[model samples]
Target: MAALALRGFGRRCLLARLGPGPALHQTIPMATTAQEEMRRFWERNSRSGRPVSPHVSIYKWSLPMAMSISHRGTGVALSLGVSLFSVAALLLPESFPHYLAQVRALSLGPALLCSAKFLLALPLCYHSWNGVRHLAWDLGKGLRLPQVTQSGLLVLALTLLSSAALAAL
Candidate 1:
């Protein structure tokens, strides 16, 4: 009886191991599917002969656009200038006036000196005036097309005048 029981158990274990436990299938490739979708999207949206969107080359230039770009540029320039100046002040010996005096001692030509001064002053003036213009716009002023154009002009004029005065000094 014991021998029969052992033989039956062994046969059951062998049948279980040989039976189909789970079904296995190959995975669908996802990367190929994604690439195909992207290609189809681009093909649908692309223009045949003409450009799809208006580029910088297609748009006409205007003063307001120029001023807007300048305002952003000046803001970045002023921020960078102030950061560098602060770092120099902390690292260099002596004080700010010492550097100024050293530059003065160089005896640089007036034209070149004034030009350097203008370059330094222009960004500050432009950023400040443009900041004021932004504030005015925030206050619900200069919303109209004409007002926007006039305010842009005023900002440029103020920037030039302030830069000139500072450079002269």
Candidate 2:
């Protein structure tokens, strides 16, 4: 009786290992099919002689276009500046004044130092004012072409004015 029960258990285990019914471990060749399809697509597109999309080199420069790009760039710069300042605040052994003192001790020329400070402040000011302008547009203000041009000019003027003020300090 014991031998018979052992044999039955062994058969059941073998069947379980074989998996339910005849749907055994199947190898799908979908990857090769996808590659072939992609190859065909490229071939078709190539044969049709349709021009590919133009890259950035194709676009002409305009004031509005330049301002739009600068807005994005300044935003990224400000975010990175804040992140670096936060990291320095946490990692530096001494307080903020200590670092300032050390920098002062370097005796860097005032003009050069002020220029660097101006460069940093300029982007921040530009991005901030432009961001406000963007928000105003979002609220359905200044959407007209004339208003856009005027607001863009305002953003530039404010950026330069504020940057100069900060540098003077």
Candidate 3:
């Protein structure tokens, strides 16, 4: 017990000589708010000529990179489209068949209808095909640069073919 007490006293002496911890806090100021902290960060980066975040302008465009970005965009678009369609279906007073008949009553030209169908299918088909490409990557395939480019091209072609076929229906 005496040795332990002596050790504790020595530690206190060492801590006092170091003049850190609570002592350091007295000399170093701290930002009070997140905004002030961010301001300090930006000021430091500005003075150092360092970018605080990455910008798309610095990246060179590539097939796989573009395909990945579009895949996300299409996925979001399809999800939003489905969600809006479901909400409209639930909230609208008219029944599905009633709206169908109303649309049919317009006697719209086939060309315009086909165009609308194609537009509707574009995102869906692209998302589906690109999703398959992503799955292939998950399976440890098409990892190389050339393979990625080829698969991206193939996905685009398949999307076009499938969209065209479905729209023709």
Candidate 4:
């Protein structure tokens, strides 16, 4: 017990010589909110001239990079389309047939109609095919550079063909 007391005294003396330091369990209250912290972090980073991400400005566009961007864009477009459609369905007073009839009344040209249909189908087809490619990547397949390029091309081809078929239908 005496030795332990001496050890504690020695530690106190050492600390006293060292002057005050942060406590092991010290809780420092935040002076800024998370938003302010983030703002400051961004400001610092911007001043340092560091890229915020793998920005397109720094890297030349590649097939894989484009495909990755398209995948995300299509996913977002599909989600927003569905969400807006659902909200419109809930809020709009008109029934489905009413809108259908109105569209028909427009008597849009066949080419325009087909183009619209293709646009609608394109995002779905691209997202689905790219998702399958991503699944293959998860399974440790089609991950090599050559294989990734091949798969991206295949996804594009399939998306175009499938979307065209749907548009024709």
Best by TM-score: 1
lDDT ranking from best candidate downward: 4, 3, 2, 1
Tens-digit lDDT string for candidate 3 (89-137): 9999998999999999999899999888899999999999999988999
- Which whole-number lDDT from 0 to 100 does residue 114 have in model 3? 88
Of the two candidates 1 and 3, the one with more favorable TM-score, higher being better, is 1
Candidate 2 — which residues are off by over 4 angstroms?
Answer: 1-51
Give lDDT per model, in order. Answer: 0.86, 0.89, 0.90, 0.94
TM-score of each: 0.72, 0.66, 0.68, 0.67
RMSD of 1: 9.5
Clashes of each: 0, 0, 0, 0
Q: Name the runs in model 4 displaced over 4 angstroms.
A: 1-58
Q: Which ten residues in a row have the lowest lDDT in candidate 2?
A: 22-31
Residue 147 lDDT in candidate 3: 92
List model 2 lDDT by residue over 29-106, tens digit each: 565687889899899988997656555456677677899999888888888989999999999899999999999999
How many backbone overlaps does candidate 4 show? Answer: 0
Ranking by TM-score: 1, 3, 4, 2
